[model samples]
Target: MNGKEALTPREFLRIADFFATNGYRLGPKIGEGTYSKVRIAERSNNGEFLAVKIIDKRIAKKSYVTKFLPRELEIAVLVKHPNVICTYEILHQGELVYIIMDYAERGDLLQLIQTCGGVSEKEAKRMFKEMAEAVKYLHNLGIAHRDLKCENILIMRDKRIALSDFGFSRLYLDQQHGDVTSKTYCGSRAYASPELLRGAPYDPRTNDVWSLGVILFIMICGKMPFDDRNLKLMLKKQMSEGVTVPETVKTQVSSECVRLVYQILDPNTDSRPGVVDILQSDWLN
Candidate 1:
């Protein structure tokens, strides 16, 4: 059933009890957001771990559950790749919804960056390669992860990447149309494309590429290429200067990597490379 479907509190508890009986045991809270909190869970029989994201029904309704939760659930179930987070099942009650998903023990990329300053070139390349693969998989399926960013990328203990959070993602085209454009201005400002900031109907795939560029820059430099502190100046810089690899980065990062970032961050959306093209770039190789 779609997330919009309503259920009684008894139904919710019965489903939760059924999961508990099967093997699931809820553990400590692991993550939190404006609308939800994630908790660690374990399968008592096999010791397998899972992340359970619980969203309050009140908050979901206020935030337009029909617009996001259903869509996210749909995409989460449709996609299955090594580089993307896996959604196992969803359970709901009268007051909350629980989304069962794969748990990454090493936390997310944002936490990694904050803890390590910036990643070494070797580490950055490894992570970026996986991320590009994940994006390519989504694009090939006609989906656009509109809210891609560092915070949405989780890291396994082995350091492999798992792209998460599909709240702002959706299919961008139909069989009848080759490419469809969107006018929605969602996602973090620092990682937004120029067309999104300019308030235009833009290609979501290209928009995703621009955000990927921003993420790569952050991974290598430990800071955003565009800051939202000065909105007007940032927009002007985004429009004219595009991305600037600092001298420090030039000295430490490979030239090919820096060049790839520039190409992906091109102010003109049409100039940005698609996920497949980016995956085949020399830098990634």
Candidate 2:
């Protein structure tokens, strides 16, 4: 059934039969959105693990129902990369939209950061290298993950980074393949770009770079680069005062890595380095 449309009684019955034949036993909820919840699930027959994202269309906002949700489904199904989570199936039953994805047993990057305080320079380079590659691939395909915070970066059991969540993601190209600007005001304020904070029509590609910089900063510094409790103050700090590394971890992170963070977190979007630039930087190698 098309996720965009409402399902009929006959269609619902058919899908129910399908579920009965090859279904997943739902487990505890691991993640959530405004109208969606991500829960761990296991295949009934083989016990294969999966993350099931269930979206309740009945209670979704009008903008999300018509705009972001559709784009998320389209892009999520379209992308396939080792450094990104894999979508196994999408089922639209009645008012529910179920998206089955690969399960990351080690949880998200945010969890790791909480447990380890801050990652070593060498370890951050390795993990962030994979994340940059994933973002580079998406950008090459004209997609911009408007939300690029640490929580969206997942960790597999082997410690590989799997970039997840595309609810705010969309192609940043026009019909003629030209650049396009967005005014969606999506993404967490802690990781939001300067232009986004100003509520201007901003280029999502550059906006994504800013969020990536914040993620990298937190990975190495074990703290947010700028305090976002006050949006106005946060924007001011983002543009002028520069990053405030914690006193405890000041000497631990390399100057080279710090330089890249500043370059990526540039207030002038045009001056900010893209993901490819980060991948080619000296710190990563």
Q: Judging by TM-score against the true structure, name the best candidate.
A: 1
- Model 2, residue 172: displacement in angstroms? 1.5
lDDT of 1: 0.85
Question: Clashes in model 2: which pairs?
Answer: none
Q: How far is candidate 2 from the true structure (C-alpha RMSD, Å)?
A: 4.5
For candidate 1, write residues 120-177 as lDDT tens digits.
9999999999999999999989899999999999998777899998888988886686
Off by over 4 Å in 2: 1-18
The local distance difference test score of each candidate is: 0.85, 0.85
Minimal lDDT window, size 10, model 2: 1-10
